[model samples]
Target: MPSTLRSSRDRPFLPKIKKSFTYHSTTNRGLTGMKSKGKMQGKALFYWSILLPALIVMLWLTLYPMITVFLTSFQNYNYISGRRSWIGLGNYKNILADQVFLTSFKNTIVYCFSTTFLEVLLGTVLALVFYGNFRGKSVFTILLILPMMLSTMVVSSVWKTLFHYDIGLLNTILSRIGLVRVGWLIDPHIALWSIVLVDVWQWTPFAFIVMQAGLLSIPQEVFEASVVDGASYQQRLLRITLPILKDQILLLCLLRTIDTFKVFAKVFALTGGGPGNATETTSLFVYREAFQYFNLGRSSAASMITLAAVVLMSIFYLRKMLNSKEA
Candidate 1:
């Protein structure tokens, strides 16, 4: 009878052990699945945390203002009244008809193209002249880049004094040299060119710096190889150097063109858009519209137009870069 009681107790304990083992195995499987899921979720959140802030700031600063300006361009907005009404293309039509605006546009294009072309040409020449080191090379380079180092507003102020019709340094020097003094800034016919000259003086250093960097990056062996093949200076420049530096040239052109298109402080301080309207640019026009006349809607439209021009120019530059990459 005692042996039968022991067997019954043993049987019950065996079933209990098996049940506990199965329960513990299930618990372990559940914990492993939870850990794996948590790790995947943590990795996803980490990447998002890294990218989210930049996206938010870009949207706030760039995207939001762009949308506002685009909407404002189509409205009739008065700064004084704070009134806005849809005006369709009225601002564009009005600006196109305005003679001052048209003159400003023409001046802007001429300034951008002429300055960019001449600067690049002069910069390339300067780079070539300074490519090989000599005594005082560093000093010469510093002097060359001095004009670019000065603030544009400060440079404008200095040039404004220099360009005075009679008492200016330029006229004084000309008089001393037995040449008749010429009007550098007073005459409407020559005011635009005078401004262009000042721009070139201030910005040529920038172009020189860029070109010098491009020149320095070229492999010395390539030039030696070309020379060994009996290539002339012009031939080596044309075939090897220029091709390698094409992208740099294009980039410089794009930057200078954009900057020249927005010329204002020099025009404002030096000529105030001219002895006539010769030195006015699109940026000056927009400034006058927005600040002088308080024509908010019209200025917005002009801003959009300027933005469009820049975008188009950027597309052209990007296409050139892409083509170079493919080649």
Candidate 2:
């Protein structure tokens, strides 16, 4: 009992020390909030720095060109002669009156619709066939995707040779089968279809891949439940599978439609819009007017028209897709 009092260091949990610590907790929280604000500001700066350059590039590459084309479409401009004059809607009128433009537009529509339909049908069927595991599935899938993997120009060149009217493999087989030696790329009636065939061969694989991805995403448990509930294979496919794949099919058609609508290289390589322009397309029409003839005004007008049509079609499909997504 000599010295009963304890030092503050040994009694740190005393009321006075506890009150002192509680008074400083607000300061600690204030420091933490300041640090968090500084970090958030730094992150915002970093993100803006990355996004600013991309936005500038997009303006230069896309926005500027689109604006220039829209303005030039109303002017009579000759690229080679460097002559430009305001012509109002003269270029559009002239193009609309041209039979060549009419034919090209018609051919584009036909190609877009026909190829999209066939590709969708074939892709859906093939995806279903290859949905389940099978023997040699890897090899078959690799072979199937090869056509889409190859360069478009190379594919066009190879198909051009194979579709030659004389001494081509296709013609040789047709002759062997006692079929007439048909003109694949030369006949006006069949030239467009020939290009379609080449496109189908090259791009059907893309559609097939898309459809297969959609098919494979379906849960196996869902299918098993359907089977256990007394659903037949066909019933499950129609009632369950097809309904789930509607969006994929629609998206595939949209992509194919856009690609086929702008067809140029195939027609240029295979037919050169020959046989009186059977395979002529809107893209080809625009290209020849701009480069070959140096008619920038008409070219711009034709391009604008084509763009408007594409925009309308895209709007329709995109609305459908968005609606489907919302549903």
Candidate 3:
């Protein structure tokens, strides 16, 4: 009450600070943005680290060789002299003009188509025969498939001897049966067909195996239902089995076509591309060009052409498969 004004010590003491304190919210946002950017950058770096090695390896192994072949195909490279000169399109032109190439091309198509058709047909029949349970079925299957298990070269050698004109088992059997002995391999007209027979014997079992797998995948319920509907065996097989196995059939066709197109070892072992180029294949021609004549450019061009054909064939099958899937 002595005075309305009080001393500073008597009232609440407040100190005056001199240091300036700035609250910058924008700085905090900037730090957060930097952290986010750092996290994003780290993740991107990790993905690149994982993928770079695989890409590098693929480039080195596959891409490098493909590039080399592509470049070499433009050059008339002599392997001994190592002399390289550009001869663009000359190899392709020569191959297209060569009568040997044309003949071999025809032979290849005929052989591939014939073998594929026969094998698939016979395979379907064999699959049907063995689909049901019977006595000694396992033994029969093993025995049937043993030919496919044998190497192509071995099978060819055995068949070469069997098809020998002079003293073959086949001729001997024909002689024993009082039938005229026929020349199997020596006859140019029949030599290619003889090779086809050997191929069919060896590969029919493969087709059978594939078809059987397709058959086994089918549900028994569908067959039971078909039976309830009084469908005949032929009707059920045609309507149900074949429809469901379409993909498998197409796949087998693709595989067999590709395999038979590249037929070489058998031809080499048996006919060596002919008694007259009657059984010559594109692969054998490529081999001769690449190795025997050292015409790398021509061989590469032929290989590319063959590859293009195969790729086209594969595309057709794949398109069918995709359409079936959609349906």
Clashes of each: 0, 0, 0
Tell me which of candidates 1 and 3 scores higher on lDDT.
1
**By TM-score, who's the top model here?**
2
Better of 2 and 3 by lDDT: 2
Ranking of candidates on TM-score, top first: 2, 1, 3
Q: Which stretches of model 1 miss by more than 4 angstroms?
A: 1-44, 50-53, 320-327
Order the candidates by lDDT, highest first: 2, 1, 3
- For model 3, the stretches where C-alpha displacement exceeds 4 angstroms are 1-61, 317-327
- Compared with the true structure, what per-residue lDDT tens digits does model 1 show for residues 1-327? 223323333343223322442344444345446668777677668778999999999999999988888888888998988888999999888878989988988999998999999999999889888776677777777888899989888998888888777778999999999998878888878888888898899999999877876677666799999999999999988999888888678778888998888788888988888767878889998898888988888888888988888888889866655554454
lDDT of 3: 0.81
Q: What RMSD does model 2 have?
A: 16.7
Q: Write the per-residue lDDT of candidate 3 for residues 1-327, one digit (tens) a residue.
A: 112112222432111111113334554445355668777677668778999999999999999887787777777877767788999988778888988888888888999999999999999889988785667776777788899999999999999899988889999999999999887887888888998999999999999877876676566799999999999999998999888877678778888998999899999999998788877889999899889988888887777777777888788866655554454
- Listed in order, each prediction's TM-score against the native is 0.82, 0.84, 0.79
Error of 2 at 7 (Å): 68
Question: Between prediction 2 and prediction 3, which has the larger TM-score?
Answer: 2
lDDT per residue (tens digit) for residues 125-240 in model 2: 99888776767776788889999989878989998889888979999999999999989989999988888888899999998877876776666788999989999989998999
- Tell me, by lDDT, which candidate is best: 2
